[model samples]
Each structure stands twice: as structure tokens, then as C-alpha cells.
Target: MTTTEIAPAPAAAPARAAHLYQLDLYRVITFALVILMHVLGATTFPQDVVSDALETPLHLTREAFFALTTFVLVFSYRSRPPRPMAFWRRRVPLVAVPYVVWSVLYWGYSLLTAEQPVGSVAAALRALGIEIANGTAWYHLYFLLVTLQVYLLFPVLMKLVRTLERRPWLVLGISGAVQIAVTCFLSYPPEGVEYSTVSRFFTTLLPYQFYSVLGAVAAVHFEAVQAWVRRHRWFVAGGLVVTLAVAETGYFVSVHNGLWPELASDAFRPYLVPWCVAAIAGLFLVGTRWAEAGRRGGRVVSWAVDRSFAIFLTHPLALALLRPLIAFVGDGVGAPWTTVVVYPATVALTLVIVEVLRRLPWSKALTGRPPLELKRAAATAAA
Candidate 1:
């Protein structure tokens, strides 16, 4: 749900500024929304219109992440450019290790939970292979795989960034148009539309290329961009509202056309591109505002940021594990109302899981973060 990206330096900050408290807030909020997306998804399991309607907007989560990740990566690269291999060497493992670990774990989990159990070890192993290859070991694992693809393309993206830097608005217009076409193919494929190795295409960098490029461009012009966004704060707010309205209306229109709720709530809708742009910009403005207000991330936000990826990895399992409890809440509380209880409980349980996992000796392998050093933590506490 996040990346190992450091925030790009702002014009007002020193070029080598190590942390952007704003980005920490941004990342933490992004991760929480991802959890909330899953929560609503689980609550609306198989599908419900109301939650589906909510999902229509929460769909911005992945695009926001892709953009933020690129912004950070490009900013860091610009600070001290790394050789392609070195960059990959340092960064890929952060995401890659977790992908492998989670894929196998979720494969086993699926076997355990399978109604039609995968009884044969060989068959199960084959399925695991397919799952990992397809980035479907679990739905969430695809993010890591897509990240790998982005990394593979990072070098090219850098070149593209430089080229776009000279023609910012023009490049954005072209890229945005391309993304809209890609979104149409993904979100509203014509009846009987098909393509080769389609599963791979479905998850390919093609879908997210626009967002990634936007991030790089933003990093390239961090100051000018921030200035522009801040200057248009009201317009950003209004645009988000209007786009969300249009998108929500589009969702119901799809439903009206007899699409299933899940299909109607598809994340890649043609209408979502503008909304995602507005939402990400809106979030950035807010993040900057928080920074302006002197709200450093502090210990609480830092702690969450450190374990955010693990929280992303573990939250779904928490939800799956809490199914019976959720069902009880749903049955007792009724439709849409159940979310009030489920979301916080899921987040609490997730952080609890993350806390336990962070203490493990191989926490980074599982969490894409450094392992907790409790003794050092205690000494620091004493200080």
C-alpha cells in the first residue's frame, strides 16, 4: 500500500531534508484508507450497493499510492542518483521479499480456508506457482508485483520524467488521455472483448503508468506544483467534490444498466481518473497544510508509518479471522450501520498483529521494514 519512498524536498526546505512530516501523514492516511477499503469490501462481501457506492471513491487508494511512491522514489533518486542495478538492489528486496513470503503464506491460508480443499500437495504447489506468477496469491499481493514492474521501468520513467519536465502540462494532458483509454479497457471492456495473456495485462504497469509518471513530474517540479496546488486549494476541493459526484452517479448508472454491484464499483472506471487526480491533489494540499500548521508526525504517526506495510499485509487476515465477529455485528446492527463497529475493530486488531510481527527476528522479511529493537527502544525510553 506504500513504498520505501522518501518525500521529495520542497522549495522551502533544505535540499537534503531527510523527512517530510507531511508525507508521513499522507502515507499513514493512505494506508488507513486501504484498510478501510478492505473493511468495506469485506462487509459488503460478495456485494452491497451502499458499500459499493463508497468503494467507488475509495478506489482512488491505489492510484494515490502509485503516485506517492513514484514521487518519493524520484525525489530520492534526484538527490543522489543511483545506478540502475544499485537502485534495484537496494529497493526491490524491500517489496520483493514480502511478496514471496506473503504469496506462500496466503497460498497455505487459502488451502486451510478452502471450501473445496486443495488436498494434493502437488496440485496445491502448482496453484501456488500460478498464484504468485499472477500476483493473485492474495488480492493485496498484486501491489507488490506491480511495484516490481514499476521498479523495472524506473530507469525509463526517469528519462520520461526529464522529458516531461520541459513540457509539464502538455505531457500531463497526453498521459491523462492514455490512462483514460487504459481505464476503459480495464473497467468497461466491451462485451466479449478479449486479449492474450490477459491476466498479466490486467495487472501490468500500463494501468498505473499515468499515476507513476505524474508522481515523477510532481517531484521534478515540487515547488511550482505545490505552489500551484496551494493557490488553487478551493478549486481542488470543488473539483474533488464534483468528480466524486459524477463518479458516484456513474456507479449507479452502471447498476441501472444491470451490472452487478462489484462490477459497478470497479476501481478503474473511466470516470475515476479525474477523481483520483483531484483526490490525490486534495490530499497533498491537506498534507502541506498540516506541515504548515507545525504538526510533525511525532511518535504515534512514525510508529504507524514504520509498520504501515505490515498493517497492509496483515489487516485482511485480521478481517478474515474476525469473520464470525463481523457477522454478529452485521446481524445485530443491520446494513451499512455495521461498518461503524467493524472498521475500528479491524484497525485495532491489525495494529496488534503488526506489533507482534514487528518483534519477530525476521520482521523486515515479512514487514518490509526493520525489526523492532526493544532493548534499544527501552534505553531510548529511559533517555
Candidate 2:
């Protein structure tokens, strides 16, 4: 489903001294959307047209997160190149430990919640092994495994970025076309098509190779990219509105034409590619505008950004714990609209979980962050 290609080599351009507050805004906003998507998926009536449409658009957040990770990476590494070994030693554990930790955490939860008992300990252990390899310990945990792949390949990706400095759009054009082809295949797989499971293809960057390169290439072109996004902000806004309507219309039409609800709402379809592009542009613009307008989020956004990893890791737990209490309230709103009540409650509880985890000694291993330093907090307060 993916085509991996490299651009020709050339010397790199020096990175500009761009402010990062915009990316901070961009990343954290996308993180919030991930939570919302999860809550909706867990709570909403899947067959409902309205709810199903929402899922299609929201699925872009996963790709957006991948782009942002590489965007930040390319910019940083370009500014200050990394020794591959040191970069891996430092970065891999950050994602790997949390990934393993949460995979076990969720796998265990699934076991305990299952109505049918596991026949034996060996079977359970084997299941866990398969779950981790398949990245199905939890649906969302695949992002971590895929991201770990991104981090591992970033050195190579960064070199690719440098090589394409002389022909920025060439790399983007190649990646974008590859992505479209991939989407087309996913949307219309050949009859009797099969995907590998033991080493699931989706758990790698193959499914999202375009997005992996998108962020990196964007970072390579950050100064120009930022200037262009900021300049065409209104265009970005208009494109988002237009693309969203088209995506929705296409989904309804597909359903009317006898497509299954699953295919009609599958986020990987070509109908939403432009929609995803526009939404990403709009998100980047808003983040950039916030930064340009004095970056007022201050501690609140920073705090949220700080805990986002933990929230990403543990929000399902928070949601699970709160479901019994919220499930009844959802009945009043009706299942199709249940997300209205459930999403906020899940977010609040997730925050509480993140706060508790932040206080632990091994916070970084569990949460991808260390304990907040009093001096830094004091400084933020003072500033």
C-alpha cells in the first residue's frame, strides 16, 4: 500500500530561528482531538450517519501527530545535527518504555474485562506477545509503535530532508503522490486482498509514509512554509470549509450507493485526503496566529502540553473508569449524541490521572516526562 522513494542528494540550507510556540499550540490541540476521537468512538452509535461522518474527519489527527513529530524533529536536528547512536539511545526509550508499559496495562485490562476466561497462562502470554507485535493491545497504542519507528528512522529522514533542500517541492510532490496512491488502494483493495498480521504492516510507517515525510519536509521548508501559511491564512480557512463539506457529501453518497458503512466512513479513503490537508493547514495557521498574537496561552497550554503524553497513554483508562458513571447520563442524551456528555468528563478525569502520574518518581517512564521541577514552576509563575 506504500511506495518508499528518496529524493536526490544536495547540501542542506541552514534552519531559521523560528519560534516554537506555534508548534506547541499545534501539537497540543491535535492531542486534544485524539482524546475527543477516542471518546466519540467509544460512546457514539457507529451506524449513525452523523457520528460516522465525524469519525472520518477526526481520523486525520493520527496522521497530523506523525507530521508534527517529524516537523519538530527535522527542524531541531537540522539546526543541531545528532549523532545517530546518541539520538536513538535518548529518544527510543522515551517512546519504547511507555509503549511497552501501556501495552501491558491495556492488555491486562482487556483480559480482566473479558467475559470468557483465558484457558491457560501460556495462552494469555502468547496473546500478549501477539497483541504487542500487532499493536492491538489497544488501538491507540499503535501510534506509539509507529512513532517509535519514526524516531528510529529520523536520522535517515533528516538526511533525506537535507538532500532535498535544493528541490523542496520535489520531495513533497513525490510523497504526496505516494500517499494518494496508498489511500486509493486502501479505499479499493483488490478482492481477496490480504495484509500481514504477525508483523502487521500497519504498525510500521508504511501506511503513513507520506505523513512521515510530510512533517520532515515541512520542517525543512519551515521559514517558507510558515510565511506561506500565514500569508494564505484566509485561503487555508476557506479550503478547510470546502473540503469538509465535500468529504461529508462523498460519505453520504457512498452509503446511498450501497457501500457498507465501514467503507463509507473509512478515513483512509481518497475523498478525505484534501480534507485532511486543509484541516492540517488550518490547524497550523491557528497555531501560528496564536504565536504571532503574543502567545498568550502561557502556563495553561504549557501544562496541557506537558501532560499530553501521559494523557495519550492513560486516557482510555480514565474513560473506562468514568464510563459507568457517565453511561447512564449518555442514555438521557441518546447514544448518537452521547459524546456531548462523555468527552468532557473523560478529559477531566484524564487530567486527574495525569496529575497523579506526574507526581510519581518514575513519571518519565510512564508518562514520557519527568516530575515537574519546582524551580521551573516557580520561574513560570514569576514570568
Candidate 3:
């Protein structure tokens, strides 16, 4: 989720310069949430497993993590102020490089194994083109693309943020309206209309603007937000749960009644804006409390947090290779048990591989972690 390189806070603001453990905790938890959602999806068996009823809610709730990631990005950008070009110079390479590398890797894998559906080289190239265009090189890469869009607009966004810094509620209201409108468009696209690649890029970020704006608002008033979080922790928690319940119930009833069946199960709908916003707020507060509770379980959390981006990139490949094993376990075990076993096993195995990659030479370009040797080599070269 830490996609970009942030400039350090100025020396005069040492207090603000220190790392925010709550945000770190948020990153780690969001990573798990995303992984869990994907695991549940990929580990499904052919049988009557958990009902669509349960899956709908889980999917809806999990999307809050997407907002969590965006929140981290804009939050970092605001705290670590840099010129527009300087920001892009440092930030874009970290993500853009990995995106291209992973895209090529996945595409080549598909070509060599004939895994993807493409009849000819032209078809394969076309598919890759679309994938890159839409930033769908992998299921997770779409985040980086949408983030890139947000980053490109960060200057403009900051202008708005500054203009409305004194009026955060107003900012939130505007963001909520934009998010709702965008979600509605996504959930119910006009009939007989086909979206182009360029449109896809813009549409992808439209629904997420609210979260970025919210994060910007939080950044401008970090102390105030944290203080508010501490004072109203219970209220935030209740709002999160209530909104989630309402949103899930709305989906459940819609699906059951066969009303808007196509949009009923979708997470990106107007109804989820409140739920996702509340969930992000509540999670941030809860994460702050967990971080304050001391360094217990710190190593494991740190390990997971450090390798989270790598895990996101490589996990789908791990799942693909392990599908047979996953299916075997499911067939041997029962419905829910299979999900339990697959989730941890997938995470553990993926982390092990990512750890190995972390130690290898030139792995940073792929995994986003600059290994010790690479850092030393760079230092030596610079000297």
C-alpha cells in the first residue's frame, strides 16, 4: 500500500515527522483483508459452499480496504510535501516499474503456457494492451493504476483541500456526493453503451475520489482528526457496524426480491459510500488503539506489513499454482473448513516466497523492497 516514496517531514516538525504506527497497523490489516477476500473467492469449491448471501457482505466490507490504501497514499503525500514533478519522479517509478515488470511477467507466463484465452499473437497483444490500459495486469494492480490517476491529480486535489481546509465537513459532503454519483454510474451503466480503455481509467478512480479527499482532509487536520477519533471511538465503531449492516441488508433484500439483480451483489454502488467511509474511519481508530497497546506481536505484524506489497503482487500466482492442492483439501474436508485451511496456507506460502525474493539481488525492482546489498551497492556507486 506504500506505493510512493514520501519526502521526510521537516526537521522543525519532528513530532509530525515520526511514523504513525496506527497507519502502519492499518496497512497490515488492510493487506490481510484484501488477501482474505481474494482467498475466499479463489478457494471456492464447486459444491454449495457458503451462500451468495454471506459472500455479498464480505465483499462489500472488504472494499473499505481499497479506500484505506488510498487514504495512506494521500496522507503520505500531504505530510511529505514535495514539488509536483519531484513527487512524480520519486513515486511513479516505484509503482510504474513494478506494474510493467509484473505485466510482462504475467503475459509471458500466459504465452508460454497458453493459460490465457487468446487464439493468436495479435489477440494476446490486444489483451495485454487492454490489461495495461486498464491497469488490470493483475487483480491487484488496478489499485496502482487508480492511485496513479489520483497522484496525477494530487496538485489540483491539494488546491481544493487547502481551499476547504477550514471546512472539512463541506469537503466530506462534496466528496460523498461525487462518490455516490460515480458509484451509481458504475453499478448501473447505461444500456447499449460500451466503455473504452481511456474511459475505464477515469471511471476506476471516480468512485474512490471520496476516500482520497477524506484522507486529504484528515491530513490537513491530523491532530484534530486523531483527537476526534479518540473522543468518539465508540460512535465511529457503531457507525461502521450500522452502515455495513444497512448496506449488506440492502444488497441482500435487493437480490432476494430480484430487484436490480445485476447491481444487487455489486460492492461499488451508491449504498456502500457511507458504509465504506465509516469502516475506514472506524478501522483507523481501532488501529490506533492496537498500536498503542504495545509491541506485542510486533515482529509478525512488521513482517507482514513489510512484505505486503510483494504479497499482493505474487499471491494470485501462488493461488493459481496451488489451486489443485486447495481443491484437494476442499474435497477431503468440508465446505467452510476448506476456506479456513486455504487462507492461512496461501498467506504463509506466499510470504515465504516473497521473503526469499526480498533477500535476492535486484528484487526491489519487483518486490519494492531495497535489499541491503542493493542499498550498499548504490551507496558505493554514489561515493
Candidates in order have lDDT scores of: 0.82, 0.79, 0.69
TM-score of candidate 2 relative to the true fold = 0.90
Minimal lDDT window, size 10, model 2: 1-10
How much is the lDDT of residue 239 in candidate 2?
A: 97
lDDT of 1 by residue, 100-181 (tens): 9999988888888989957788888998998888898888888888989988888777766667678988888888889988
Model 2: which residue pairs collide? none
Tell me, by TM-score, which candidate is best.
1
Clashes of each: 0, 0, 0
Between prediction 1 and prediction 3, which has the larger lDDT?
1
Model 2 ranges with Cα > 4 A deviation:
1-19, 195-199, 373-383
User: Which candidate achieves the best lDDT against the true structure?
Assistant: 1
Which whole-number lDDT from 0 to 100 does residue 188 have in model 1?
A: 60
- Ranking 2 against 3 by lDDT, winner: 2
Residue 26 of model 3 has an lDDT of 75
